[model samples]
Target: MSSPTSVLLAGGGSAGHVSPLLALADTLTRRHPDLVVTALGTEEGLEARLIPARGFGLRFVPKVPLPRRPSADLLKLPGRLKAAVDAAGAAIDETGAEVVVGFGGYVSTPAYLAARRRRVPIVIHEQNARPGLANRVGARFTTFVATTFSTTDLPHARRIGMPLRREIATLDRSALRDEALAHFGLATEWPTVLVTGGSLGAKRLNDAFASTVAALSRGGVQVLHVTGQGKTFVPDVPAVGAPYVVVEYADRMELAYAAADLVVARSGANTVCELTTVGLPAVYVPLPIGNGEQRLNAADVVAAGGGLLVDDDALTPHWVETELIPLATDGDRLAVMARASAALGEPAADEQLADLVELAWGTRA
Candidate 1:
């Protein structure tokens, strides 16, 4: 019945899974210094670097990708799954874990299997409106399932919103606006828009915005474009009416959020949550690939009038000029959208999740 002395977290391979794992780890350790938080991930996962950087221990398992359709990989999956589950079981044993919490991903299936085999209580957090396969499987047996979107279809689901890092969670955009503008080397006077396509960048967003730099500058709109690592390109037309800034990555995303009057980006779970968390109006461009979950991620915000969703094929240079530019310049409409965005933000998800983990641990107690 006592609090868990040590906990094992499972999920990785992408920011979608790793970000929330890091957030929850931080919350747990902050609340209980004696609680040990170790992550179970693969060597290829972003967690390899991120988890250790956050001062948490990490264990590795083989990455087992569940093939969507029949293939050679699918045939080999049974063996790979057993190996990963064995590794996950060893990780739990080595840590003497009292409970296991999982954010669904490739690594999650093994963790779920291992934890179940060990009789370790399981907690699940699904970050998408469209549940991923890993989470769907874990949800069947875990009574402690939490979700970001209320519409997320998972058994035993409870809506806890997306967990955000401390920096983004505590950011005061208006208060930090001046410093953010200076940090990004943009004029404080111009209306600003932030365009991003995650760490690897998006060709669609890159192409569409690159073509419209001059048009945006002429309209006195400053642009902060995070073009992802290695996708950086010099704008052919330099800053004239306002600064047209571009960078390979935004190491300090809080500053980017602080400086923006508007955002144009993909509608991944993280992006959607961050925009709503800070009350920033956005033009969400769902990625063309995947299970069409990106479109589902932004549905509530778009319906709430906090953001706009544009099909990937339709977000072009012409559309930016005709639609986005006008919306960027509309101060009255931006204020309304900002209010709606703030209304939908759940700043306390991290704390709320900590409470649920407490409840789940009690089941073992």
Candidate 2:
């Protein structure tokens, strides 16, 4: 057997899945210029735009959400899954896909099934500390399974770490410090905290940071707050000494990462990986909902003394004044955390994952 000439990469609905999918796609294509890579996702997913924008062909599959409880959607699941699998199989057939790589989301289940039916090799990548249902199902048919977090419970799990964007994985914070400061219009004198609430912005984070902008400035700390798209945050008072830069969104996150000494944001799998990979300290405020995966995602780093992990509700304006202010201003502490974060990060994860894909294809009969 030889490496796959063509492969179908499936996953979507969120950045956690799409980011890795895109990163792996880029690596595989770069390694094999003649390789044919097509993405499978629903139009509703972020992948619909991201995949195509990245210059990969995308095939649509019906988004199938597995019900948590007995519902009318449960009754319709079989038909939806069948249709999605059929669509996925057709994509495989059309592209002459010899293997399938799935990142575990709404589109992964069908990609796994279709590849199994076609006798094509399947490689699964589980992103979170807790595996999602799609990856759990996909794992059954594949011996090649990769995970971002070591604590992730999945069959045949191999922790290759997260496949991160090239910009994030290769970011040299010190080297880009000046560029970052100039881009965000921050002073070089003050220690900066980067505050983000993911793409959509968490109201809790927005409000907390909004209320404490003056407090942070008074502590001689600069702040770069990305308030998410369409999410606005108006500061109550002007800065006392340091700059308070607020933007709706950051197109160049690498610059933002470069500018900040500490990050105050959600502990998303991608965020954890990127921050660690780039060797930046953070204050992780995990989203309060879902299966508690966000909190789990930051466990290893927090345990390693890389960052502070706090509950969503626990992350308040008061905490910013009491805890975050001191931490950001303490240069010695932030340096120690940055070293710990870098130690835990796997910068070569994209290459390692690409190896697994090749290994899986090579073993195919």
TM-score for every candidate vs. truth? 0.97, 0.97
Ten contiguous residues with the weakest lDDT in model 1: 234-243
Please list the residue runs of candidate 1 whose C-alpha ends up more than 4 Å from where it truly belongs after superposition.
Answer: none
TM-score of 1: 0.97
**Model 1: per-residue lDDT, tens digit, 1-365?**
45779999999999999999999999999999899999999999899999999899999999888887999989899999999999999999999998899999888999999999888889999999999888999998788999999799999899989999989988899999999999999898888999999999999999999999998888777899999989999986653588899999999999999999999999999999999999999999999898999999999999999999999999999998889888888999999999998888988889888888888888883
In angstroms, how far off is 209's CA in candidate 1?
1.3
